[model samples]
Target: MDQKLTRQAASRVPRPLAQALSVVEEAAQGTKLWCGVTAALACLGGRRGRRAGTAGLAAVAVAQLVSNGMCKPLADRPRPPKGWIPHDEVEDRPDSSSFPSGHTAAAVAFAAAAAPAWPLVGALCAVPAAVVAVERVQSGAHYPSDVAAGAVIGLGAAWFTRRSPRLLRRCTSRPSP
Candidate 1:
């Protein structure tokens, strides 16, 4: 069922849409595009925007580490079959394990983390995040389950980061130093 769905989604992507998604996929390389977006928001949003941008970037970093470093290695799942993708995109496909998509993780993490600080920015960030996730499937780089897992990991990372300050305060409050 997963394979069937992935194939169906990949096949239905039109050339222009695929080209656009390919650009998104490329920008997501190493989460550079998202970092840039977050930085821009920070610059434009004042103090509150800065805070949200910082948190969002932090969450993205954590999600990348958790998804690519830990989860992907552990899962060691293969990417979707090459034949499922269009010829032009074949070379753009990553060679790494694909259980949890690092790109999608970073996207969702940024949006989820940023939304708490600035609802408008957070809401805005969601658009690209959703595109990145769908692009992962549309580009034939990941299965639907891979995108889902990445989203979950991203949300978890954001939640953890949000709670870190409280956790640190509790730990330090009792310290002798």
Candidate 2:
């Protein structure tokens, strides 16, 4: 099923859209796009924007670490076969495990974390995050399940970022006997 879906996604998307998605994937290779967004928010958005940018960056970091460093090592899943993806993108695919997409994870983490700080900006971030998820499949970098897991991990990272400060405060506030 995963292979069949990957093949379909790779073949069915319109050429123009696929090209654009490929560009987006490239922009996201090292979380470059997210970092730029964070910078834009921090510089132009004033207080709330600064908070949103910081939170988004933090979540993206956590999500990238968990999806790429921890989960990828543990799962050891393989990328979709190049035969399934009828494009030059196959040559550029990562050699790493594909159980979770680091790009998707970071994208979702940034969008989710930022949304609470600034709703409008959050929604805006979500658009590209969704694009990255789709690009992962269409480019044969990940299976649908991998993208789903990445998204879940991203949400978890966002949750951790949001709660950690308070959790730390609570832990410290409890007088060590």
Candidate 3:
């Protein structure tokens, strides 16, 4: 299934779209795109930007940690086979497990985390985040399952970050067992 899907994507996607996806992929490497957005928010967004930026970054960090540090090391899956991807960039795919996509993870985490604090900014962020997810598969760096898992991890991280304070309050408020 992954092979056939990748083959169709490689053949069917337009050249301009492929190029655009490459740009998005490069910007997303190691969350550089997100850092730039967060910086802009913190600088020009006033108090609301600061809150959203902080929350977004925190969630991204957690998502990256869980996706890259823990999950990648445990899962032994690899990048798509070379013949499946008819792109030159296939050679650039990382030699690591592709069970989850760190880029997608960070993107979703940032968008999800920021949405509650700044709805407009979060909506804007979601566009690129969605692009990042597609780029992961279109680039042949990950299968669709990898992107899905990464998105799940990202959402989980965002949820945890958003809820941790309240959860802590609940835990602390409880009487000694």
Candidate 4:
């Protein structure tokens, strides 16, 4: 079912839109686009933006570690069948375990983590995040389930990072010695 939906999405998307999405996908490679956005926010967006950017980048890093380092290895899911996509976009597809897309994970993690500190910036980030997720499917690089799992992982990483400081404070403020 996931593969069928992925193939349908890949096949039905118009060529121009697919081309645009391919560009988005390329920009999101290794989370470069998100990192740049985070850096800009930190540099120019003042105190709140800096905090948000830091948290967002940290969440993305955690998401990457979990999605690419752990989940992909454990699930070992294959990329969507290349044969289903009859377009040049297919050539850009990655040769990695596809479950829990690292791009989508980083995208969501960065956006969600930033939202708490800077809602507007987070909202802005969401546009590209959404595009990256859809492009993963439209390019036949990931199944729908893979994207969904990636989103969940990304959100989880953001949530965990948001709470971690309090956890650390509690552990450290124990009236040591």
Cα TM-score per model:
0.93, 0.97, 0.95, 0.94
Report lDDT per candidate: 0.88, 0.92, 0.91, 0.90
Q: Write the per-residue lDDT of candidate 3 for residues 1-177, one digit (tens) a residue.
A: 877877787667788998998898799898899899989999999999999998999999999999999999999798888888877877888899998899999999999999999999999999999998888888788998899999999999999999999999999999997
* Candidate whose lDDT is highest: 2
Q: Cα-based RMSD of the predictions, in order?
A: 1.8, 0.8, 1.1, 1.6
> Local error of candidate 1 at 65, Å?
1.0
- Candidate 1 residue-pair clash tally: 0
Using lDDT as the measure, name the better of candidate 1 and candidate 2: 2
8, model 1: CA deviation in Å? 1.2
What range of 10 consecutive residues in model 2 has the weakest lDDT sum? 85-94
With a 3 Å backbone cut-off (N, CA, C), the pairs that clash in candidate 2 are none
Stretches of model 1 off by over 4 angstroms after superposition: 175-177
C-alpha RMSD of candidate 1: 1.8
What local lDDT does model 4 show for residue 77? Answer: 82
- Per residue, candidate 1 scores C-alpha lDDT tens digits across 72-162 of 9899999988887755565577788988999899999999998888889889888888889988998888999999999999999899889
